[model samples]
Target: MIRFQLEESDREVGRFWIGFLHAFRTIFPGFGQRFLAGIVDHHQQPAPTTIAQLTNELEQKNWELILENSSLISSENWWSGFVEWLQPFKEKHSIVFLEDSGKMMRKAGEELIHGISPKLRIALTASEIWWPRWFSEEFPGENCTELWHKLRVANNIKDFSSEIILPKRNLLTSLQNQLRREDQELLIQQIRSMINWLQDQGEWLEAVRLMQNNKDFEQAGEILQDKVEDWSSSGADPLEVLFWLKELPGVLLTSKPVLCLSAAQAANKLGFNFQVSYFISAAENNLYALQHFSRNDKLWREMVLDESGTTVQGILAQITQIRIGENHETEF
Candidate 1:
């Protein structure tokens, strides 16, 4: 019944085993008290070499202890040192242990794959194989793609959920600084596929941001356009609209006017007069810039109209009507 906490920092150092040993001592008093005393050397600590010798002795003793009392450790503590007992209980207990620890320990299941036989390895769920924290600090930068390819082939994996895809997305993300031009381009395609999957779930903005991070500016712009249109059509929050508008890479001159139009429409719907004016002014200023690069007026017009259910042309017409009315009043 001993409670153990896994600190985020504990995962980085080898002292995680020490924490487990301390907790194990609490549950089984007789064994734990003797084990801790031998390891700690009666609080009269020795020199560095002696401490190292003591640690080795502690590990050996722990093995003997785990061998005799496997039930003392819970599945949650499996990665703590209970894995050492797997040799005896592996056949009947392996899968359940793998499933439980795989989800809980974050990275232990992937490491456990190295210790077990191929048959046991194959029994692991896709989730365990592609465990979210599969990428570790010591991972070689360039070989990540090859490593994923090997895992896919070894596991006969044909499809990927977000669990698998997101890790690959992160691997591709990290490789951005280290990969060659050709390799980056190759990863861009994989990144694009995952982004597309995310978009289907209404995660357009996050996907757009990731694409922008990868410097896939063109694709990011395309997705941003779709996002602006989708948000405007759905009557999304004006503040949320502004948040995304600011995230757009300003160098995408062609998308700027279209996004501004959508934002203006969203702001107007929410009765935010200041935001509507800001976006309308932006769209008007960018129209001339859009004209220089874009030849398709029809597509530009549709971007302002179809997506928001009201056209830039319509807004201009309303202004004209007001101006004409004021002119007539002045004449009268």
Candidate 2:
């Protein structure tokens, strides 16, 4: 089969011609070759036989069939047939019919929204109606644009804060109430999947923020703990990690000595001497509490005490020496 090996600029035109030719063929079978022959110089080769051949010749020759045959291409019968052919083959061909016929797509989406139940409409519009690239420029309505902006801001850390977070949180809660029971469950599953994907991509802050937004505090804490462990083991940058640890709920932060030690190590790396002392003190206190109250908890002991049996006090001494400008390396 003939192919165009289309460039980025040519892809939309290519899809349009391919779709148009298929529509033309459906309307006038056995005449495609003759049409192709008439459109270009055919002295050396016989008229192209297949739709692919016709599309390739037209594109290679730089013939603008879409504009040349605009009337025929846009005629009601032809356009309908083109859409019908496009719907099934678009995915296979990597065709987004919307790029060429966005007005029609928008109209159809609006009509679909009108016909669906409110719950389904919200779910469908949020999940599918707005194309990713066109969200800011071509989004259909003001409300949609605002909602999309809020969603975007919610994911971003720089834009996230207590005052800004509350509005987005309330907006999300409002939208959640409009979704059906099953759709609500599906939305949660999708958010969870997105969180897992973010974590896999090493976007721990973004993942934790999403969990916190959804009120999954326990899961968020678990992710924070995992992030600390990852940094401790892999020697990753700890500045941002320490900041997040400082923001954790007081009760949660104080309950885990390993977390405090991780924060202390992070503070030490960033040259925050006061923070280093504070975190080390907190870790010492939490270690004592764990030893007295939960002696059976070997996991905390294993994490807090190094394999060399270095205690919290030893780690503190090492941090003190480093803070005093002593050229000594410290490990947590």
Candidate 3:
């Protein structure tokens, strides 16, 4: 059995455990704690040395993970996985790692967006899509490079911002202070509009859809702040952005980072910021709910495989195998 770790660099919080094995792929090559075998799962009370044990542990940890996620997950829930209610498992395996990775990644993405802006980070994600590293090899390309410049700008902004977060206190202070009154005001407008747009989960979904189109993201975000200020009056929410520095309630709440703040710190090193962070944050924060769409994402893999004109087995092999040259991918 091969012990594969999510090499530290490849683990982006927003993209992390969010969606592991797709629903359609759930049973393949085996799942649950089965990734860890005998040494971890042999006993009546097996230790988590293998995937089966890992699954059992994941189940126990899922609840706790959700509890931890309560910060974003919140204490209340209108609906839980209805399937779990109908039939419970003999051993516990959780969707929590996916949740943790999802939430954490969202947070990371949002934080990155604050500086990098989620738009740019996303471009980078797209640019790297077919790269041997992350893509499962079979994945087709969307060729969204037209917005490459826009995305690159956002990533550059984030890179510069990360530099602001250096060990030197003076640099942080200078950057913090230099983020002038005008910039702060612009931030307020951005947050307000985003919060307004993100009112419900559906609108949020549409926005996310828009993000997938490189043209949409670069245009929407690149011009967003500046455009809003172009029309707004002076003195709307003077203290809004400053409020976020301290993680203030309500005011900063709307100021969601394009990438998630939770996972932001981790991605600070990604040479490029992918903008999927904000949406990631929304799901993790539970500020947005996951609505069931008419089309099941489970079928996404099938559609992808169909495009590749290969059996699922072939596609599976394509996705699981790492691509070369793409950073973070373990070359075989």
Best by lDDT: 2
Arrange candidates by lDDT, descending. 2, 1, 3
The lDDT of each candidate is 0.44, 0.47, 0.28
- Best model per TM-score: 2
Model 1 bad stretches (over 4 Å): 1-183, 198-206, 251-255, 267-275, 288-312, 315-332
| Candidate 1 per-residue C-alpha lDDT over 17-52 given as tens digits, one digit per residue, 9 for 90 to 100 | 445555555654433322222221111222345334
Model 3: per-residue Cα lDDT over 247-306, one tens digit each: 212223224332123222222222113312332343234322221321554443333212
> Which should have the higher TM-score, number 1 or number 2?
2
Off by over 4 Å in 3: 1-30, 33-52, 55-185, 198-202, 206-332
TM-score of 1: 0.37
Model 2 RMSD in angstroms: 23.6
Lowest summed-lDDT stretch of 10 residues in model 1? Answer: 37-46
Give candidate 2 misplaced runs (Cα > 4 Å): 1-186, 200-203, 229-238, 293-332
TM-score of each: 0.37, 0.39, 0.19
Error in Å for residue 328 of model 3: 49
